[model samples]
Target chain A: MSATRRIRFTLNGQAAAAEIGTHETLVEVLRDRFALFGARESCSQGLCGCCTVLVDGHAVSGCLFLAAAADGVKIQTIEGLASGERLDPVQEAFLECGAFQCGFCTPGFILMTRQLLDENPAPSEDEIRHYLSGNLCRCGAYPEIIEAVKLASHKVKSRTPGGAAP
Target chain B: MTPFDLVEPPSLGEALKLLEPDDSAVRPLAGGTALMLLMKSGFFRPKRLVSLRAAGERLARIRIEPNGELRIGAMVRLAALEWAPEVRRDFPVIGHTLRTLANVRVRNVATLGGHLAHADPHSDLPPVLIALGACLVLAGPRGERAVPVEGFATGHYETVCKGDELIVEATIPPLGRRRAAYAKCTTRSADDWPALGIAVAWDDDGAIRSPRIVLGAATERPTRLKAAEALIAGRTLDGALLTRAGEAAAEEADVVADARGSVSYKKQLVKVYVARALRAAGAGPAAP
Candidate 1:
């Protein structure tokens, strides 16, 4: 075993710290230390996006990223997307569209959608499919997920002046 | 898991010191995408990992020099390059390849240097870099040296990069009037490495110049087809010429079987994609 190193970063709007092994991935750090169970570890490799999280406001795979590499960076899991009493528009859409079945892949999908909206507020069906390709839905809820993303895009657009239509 | 010490070098100099000849056990760690996967599979067992993220020298930046050459930092993320105005304007083919690399999430994390160093025959960057006639700047304990992209990778995951050296940047000469395109054959729209990829570029004079062709995932290392290039050089491209060049490329590439596709299937795809890329490059600029 190797000596653990100190890792410091902002987690879900709070300053967080952990002593992580060099080999420990961010997914392990989130699930094991910080207890952010929302970031699932389905594939453990990068193939499955179950461990996806937002780093510096961009979606990235937590499984392949070293915990130590995130030092001083801002990280957000699915748990961070919502306010104390309100759901993010993406979460609301997912719920309305029944975009998830097993719910294991929902967190990653939500985070990915958040990134998509950040970059392109109003994406077409093809654009949504292209952006969300990293997040796999083993339960085959893709059509519903696409619908949910469209719904969320509309919801987001209504709030912004001159936003692209759904 | 085999134990290894982790060293986070604060600067390139310190990283090079850690990677000195005496410490053959030290390996510079970049994005950790391929290295981590190889480690998980027990393919490599380095005693120490010198993290390059903090070294300041490994991050992304694109600047046009006084001579008009574009200097790209090796550590630049694929996603950043995809949106860079300079790259999109001058090298749209590179931008296209970046947009199609794996997926958005991977693009956000995979660095150019990491991708190049990984030297996976199936990777998208090698062939593109070769076509651009890019030069790699490497820093090591012995100091810095430059190597052309064409001769950079020796075989498989192997590279001319010494264990103590780190690829700092890649410099690309301006493409004044050359047209270029990259095409890949993959089963899915996302998250799939190309079974075969081809990048083609030609100079402005209506005559073929710098006819670079690289076939990925078809050999242990990305192989350049000089014979095919010779066949196309100084000649105007057409369907017949493209077919002959594709045939020559297929013959030059050492396609092999992997979990993704069969050897014959990959070779066929290489020929097809090469022809397609050539045709696309020959099509010239789009209407404004």
Candidate 2:
């Protein structure tokens, strides 16, 4: 055993720092140091997406990442999706559609969807299902979740004004 | 969870030095996808972890050599491969496999070397890499040496790599006109390791040259089905030939029973996926 190492990175939009052990997971660090409880720790084996987060704009499981690996990287947790109290369109759609049942898996679903839309603005139904395949909704709210993503796609496309529908 | 010292080595040289002692209580940490879970579950207890993150440059780049071989940095995440244009254009099969791998989140952090080194029977990389005739470049006190992917995994959760050696990159020979495909049978669309995976590739002239067939989650380590491959090599693929190849693969593989599927079911799946992959490799009719 050794003293914890100091790690520095960008969390959401702010500079973040934490002292963590070599074996500490990103989910543990995010939940403990920054108090971002949104990155849940369910099934810490990386089997479940309850610990999903965005690292450098790419979705990843926090439980599978070493805390030290986040050094100098840009991270976006569920809390980072909003800007000045305005929820991101995907978040709003999830809420409007009641896509979450237990809410325990909402953050992971939201983050996964954000990554999916960023890569493909208007993904097909099959693509949406494929991309969100890792984030398990044990409560079986899949239909609502798919509908919410479709609604969010429409909202994003319509707001582009003259942009073509994705 | 047990606490341990974290050392971020700035380069591969430094990382190897940290593991120089054959019995040193240190492990090289990659994506930590498997390592993290193992540690958390109390399966692995190392005194120190040499973080490979600082060796970032070594892991993020993909280069093609003048000899027409493709070199992938050991650290290249699975997601990066899925999104890389060159990989998609030249090695569409690689992208296809990555796309089906666990999930988007896992792909974002899981590194190629880590996955290969983990040597899990059900892992997605081994079968594909072996089929592509890929080789791994390892660096250590003994300097760099290349090992064929087929011989890299010695057994379940085991590899030929020495404790001090670090996998720096993987080299995949160009496919040129060869068409390739990968198919797997799993319980779910994501997060579950395959019950059985099959990879197939053939050379130009459509003669089924350089045929390599592999099966995962069926044995202690991902293995090549030489008997099945022998059935098609140097012969033009036809309906009867493809069926015979699939049967040979099923007979050659040592499939084990798991929760996802039974041994008998896996044997059937081996035949089905092998046939499908061969057909998908352009052995069958094309869309009208």
Candidate 3:
């Protein structure tokens, strides 16, 4: 394709199209084209997971991922985690546990916790710490975040049949 | 980041033809994690990037050959390596190395080929690959050639790979009776780039044989501690032998200082981590 090319993909479930530069990052495209602000870029480097997004059901750093690479993949973001009225179990757990103070990194932590629990229905404290180590919470609410992840695991397990949405 | 034309080649052959041996600005783009970082900071500017994402499944399969060697395609994501039953069952040391490599997000998107091709001295995988006696198959316009992982990287962020040559696959020999362990010291977070990395693999025939000790991160490149390996070879791995080997490794390594640590501190780290990794492998593979 040319320097700026059109790419078509499913964003948060709806089919979308955008003309993105080859150098444009997925985070820039989501925020600029889709007005999706949940995935904010804190550290341009992949070190801080604030710009975390799900590409084809796998978590990836939006900051490092090229927008051109998202052409045919299904993308999910923090904005898409909740349905019309119901919040995701992880989000509910985060709210109930007050897992964040500044809240700049809450969306990333919640999204990552969702992925972790999906892969591991029940993760030990050590596992939780290890999995979420990439996403930083400068507010220093790590203990409560761990508690929230555990609570979310229980809530997710106890949900009624078919309550889980893809 | 400057604008550039991104071309998606449908197959490995076409991708190679699209590459230019003399043009550094025209590069083959794999996972794009490391390259994106450099581009964002204005370290590198590119004219075109030949994306290999759609380049068929030939470079994405993890298959065990008839001879019991594991052939991992270059485009195989790091997460696939972590979750692959064959990798976890046979080469558990690789699994151990991936556990603390970056994080779930990076592993989900970053490819194994990019990790080695980047050749960052602080990377954790090259030393592990070298210790396992791995070989990388590089494909170019001329043909394909195999290079040992030890010599694949020449210096920090440098490799013997020509601009037109692309790594197609990495072949790791079956573990057999050899058990391996990798230990790294991260100065910041546990997942941060290592300050010192030590990987040891020895054929445990009830005693250490053909022991391979490789040191990384603390040195300019992944290097084999030949003196230490010779001393430990054909010897039983005991407490005293482990201590002496650690000292020998520290003395033999060409350690250089970086922001991560001072040269003296890394030498000490080499001493400690070498013994620690040897002890872990000395326990033997718990399963077999």
Candidate 2 vs candidate 3, TM-score winner: 3
What tens digits encode model 1's per-residue C-alpha lDDT throughout A42-110? Answer: 876677789999999978889888887899999999999999879998999999999999999999999
Clashing pairs in 3: none
Residue-by-residue lDDT tens digits, candidate 2, B98-183: 88888787788888989998888889889899988999999988789999999899998889998878899999998777778888
Q: Name the candidate, 1 or 2, with the larger lDDT value.
A: 2
Off by over 4 Å in 1: A161-166, B1-3, B20-24, B57-59, B284-288
Sort candidate 2 into its docking category.
medium
Residue lDDT tens for model 2, A84-122: 899999999999999989999999999888888878988
Docking class of 1: medium
* Candidate 2: residue pairs that collide: none
| Candidate 1 lDDT by residue in tens digits, B76-194 | 88888888998888777888888778877788888888899888888998888888788999987778899998889888878999877889988888777777788887765466887
Relative to the real complex, the DockQ score for model 1 comes to 0.61
Q: Can you tell me the CAPRI class of model 3?
A: medium
The deviation in Å at residue A64 for candidate 2 is 2.3
Chain B alone, TM-score, model 3: 0.98
Winning model by TM-score: 3
Off by over 4 Å in 3: A160-166, B286-288
In candidate 2 the C-alpha lDDT for residue B119 amounts to 87
- Assess each prediction's global lDDT (C-alpha) against the native: 0.83, 0.84, 0.91
The order by descending DockQ is: 3, 2, 1
Which parts of model 2 are misplaced by more than 4 Å? Answer: B283-288
